[model samples]
Target: MKLDVTRRSREAMRAYLAEALDGCYEGEPTISPIEGGRAAAERQLSNFDVRRYASRNHVTRGHVSRMSPYIRHGVMTLREVRDAVFARFGRVGESIYKFVFELAWHQFWQEVYAGLGDEIYADIEDYKFPPPVWQETLPDDVARAETGLVCMDEALRELYATGYLHNHARMWFAAYLIHHRRVHWSVGERLFFAHLLDGNPPPNALSWQWVASTFSSKPYYFNRQNIEKYTDGTWCRQCTAACPFDQTYDALAGQLFGNA
Candidate 1:
């Protein structure tokens, strides 16, 4: 059998987002956002606005987040991507391992999240919820923040302009969104699914929980300055990668790197 994929580079994926799927969504999130968190682990919503991903750089929405949804929904399978890679790299050794690792990395996280306590769907139990809230009560301000409009960083603006974001940048983005902004990661998670083309529920949802300390907190806060040192002045001018907190940074970076 011959399998031909017209590859959509991260760049191409961004361009095709809203354009490819706009006619879906009849009402406002049939499943309310907060309550929806606990629904069926995840729901596969097909059809999205083509215009949503058509910004000169909308690939962030249409392409990147779309992958996991399709894979999760049975529209496509991980096996397909694997077969394509295996054909080129074959089995065994680091070369093949590297290729397989990326896909597996995605899978591993999904599993990790499924087992998290049901509370994983929301913020840490210990934290207090202030305002009376509901699944459907998503404020427009919160919507703007997750889209990277709340912050004034070039990395974030680019994230807004382009739908795609480097995985590394997402970590920083989530932490800042959850911590600095005082917004719940679950809120952030919902926005991600709404906008991301490659949004994988497991990785996307659980990762947000992890960052918010509902999961783990060895490096309590990812240092902002440390990231600047590592990136060497590239990416995230508005939000530096260096973690603001230190002790947690030392302990956490280890787990993060190991996991990554």
Candidate 2:
């Protein structure tokens, strides 16, 4: 899988990139997998082409996430992913730039984990302070939250079927899950990462922490109006509704419930 990426798709991607790059970039590729981001970019750009790859090619949505499983396995490298796309459409210009930029985002997120290390696992600096003692078992409410009881509509249902959420939906969900539902971020993180196709450790975990006020940022807040407005009528579980993290979750769920 990884080899195919580096060899075939990468070759195509690079071919395109080489052309798009032209005299515009002489110094190097922005990153190199071998020497690190900067070096890798420079090295890969060394020999590139434009005409051969990017044009008239169909970069499938399936293709976008296909490599992720392999990437998780470590058998496939980011270099291969980049090369494949670039070699194919590097010359295609702006379109490929967006694609490449997304790939770069993947790289950037990985570095966030690498640089932050266990700190990614730590509690956020802001907020009133004691970490909520988590229960041994997740609450019944947690499962209901997934049932779309919180926000029932096409988009919420889509999350269940597709096992995915859009960027905005995800933030809203996370906000609802943490601040409104009153659930522990760790529980929410595990549930999400366990299911999401695009799950990456740092981003998944840390971002949840961010929503949970376990991160340094101010606690996120949303009412029903925000959900109704943004989802374009796709979902409408008012913020006033029950959430996994709401104060009620603390009162009624589990044996000890969470007041302990």
Candidate 3:
């Protein structure tokens, strides 16, 4: 005798079955799995080369070394990555300088975390202006990837499906959550930590604070123009929602903080 099941029950059964098979895979992953161990990391280091280091900010134009997972897990040391860059580019120049500056940020965050310990999870500085009204919990729309913002929804989907995002995309999403959605940074930080393969507590939490203006001199914001420029207008082209990021920086400042 077969029992009839509701749609919700069917979904539950599927999810349970998937969870049960989680680590039993003997075949290739649907998405390219980030290979583990020192050999894979070394290969990635070789591919990063010097040119890629110079173009890290050209999110839509070029590639970045997808080596953060290796770095985060201690499979590749920070010093080793730096040495590789230096060897390829020499000690000083715009490209080498930019690359080292970014590396320094990771070390700086680690130092701050070591000093503050768990306090790194809290607001590091007073809000530069009045804080926006915020909920401690992540918004349902963001969690469900139903935010109606094409750029944000796409970024969230990439993060969930691949466990990675371009660094610019991360900043854009964090700023949207903190200043635009008016959610606390901690909520976004926690969400990032949960999904990011490269997620480290210090860098994840501190970087969110940097975007929210709790650690920086002012909040970071991006409008439609900035997104279009960096993303090559892909998200803006087919977007149907009324874009909150459509305004100029001055206008956004006025709307977000009553300052222009």
Candidate 4:
């Protein structure tokens, strides 16, 4: 159907979906800030910065390209993105290695999905540590962005509002849900899949597993100090909750996993 999407305003488009897909889709239809289509994708690609992405991707407010939605939707292909990087930055060396490696990691997940299919929905391996009985569903507080932790609450609000979350934020949120709150990794994976613009089953599931210690050699948890440093205390500065992550790793491990 050569439908002119431009004919309808964002509200009209959302209303159409709500009427057309009724039970299949719920909630208020908020548009993503990321634009769609080849033109937008190309523009974003043209502005790619390899060096800053490499150096700052670990931080919340990083220089990483927000190309995920375009790439995920096939408005741009992985090869196209990789070629764009090389076209601008020349052959991969120290500067572009981290960015290219990330692209490669994305491809690696795609390959794994192709090979394993639905098996990735289940735990790929056993947990590295004895795990507590985890909640089978995402908690109402976390889902509603009311989890008193400013970092997690803000991340959830962003995910709900934009269908996007910075990678570091995603990690922190997942760790908070899986380790701090003792929710199942699958619960978090499903929640992300439902909201993320770039949500792919392989990476989403496996990454959650990695955080939960079901696929990795160790569970990934972050302390208040790490969050404060990377986010430049953006969330911590205003947070008033009894900070659960405000402890050493050894303390967290012992408290979260000891005798579980």
* lDDT (Cα atoms) of all candidates against the true structure: 0.50, 0.54, 0.84, 0.85
Candidate number achieving the greatest TM-score relative to the actual structure: 4
Off by over 4 Å in 3: 1-32
Model 2: CA > 4 A from native: 1-70, 74-76, 88-99, 128-137, 146-162, 213-216, 221-230, 237-260
Question: For candidate 4, what is the lDDT?
Answer: 0.85
In order of listing, the candidates' clash counts read: 35, 37, 0, 0
Runs of candidate 1 with Cα error greater than 4 angstroms are: 1-75, 109-120, 123-152, 217-220, 229-231, 235-260
Sequence-dependent TM-score of model 2: 0.51
lDDT of model 4, residue 194 = 93
Tens-place lDDT per residue, model 4, 134-200, is: 8998788888899889999998889988899999999999999988888999999999999999998
User: Candidate 4: worst 10 consecutive residues by lDDT?
Assistant: 1-10
Across 144-174, the per-residue lDDT of candidate 1 in tens digits comes to 4444432324445444454445565677667
Q: Compared with the true structure, what per-residue lDDT tens digits does model 2 show for residues 183-259?
A: 67777787778666557798788778777666645555555455545544334434443543333322423312233
**Candidate 4 has what TM-score?**
0.91
Clashes of 1: 35
C-alpha RMSD for every candidate: 12.5, 15.1, 7.4, 2.5
Residue 54 CA displacement from its true place in model 1, Å: 30
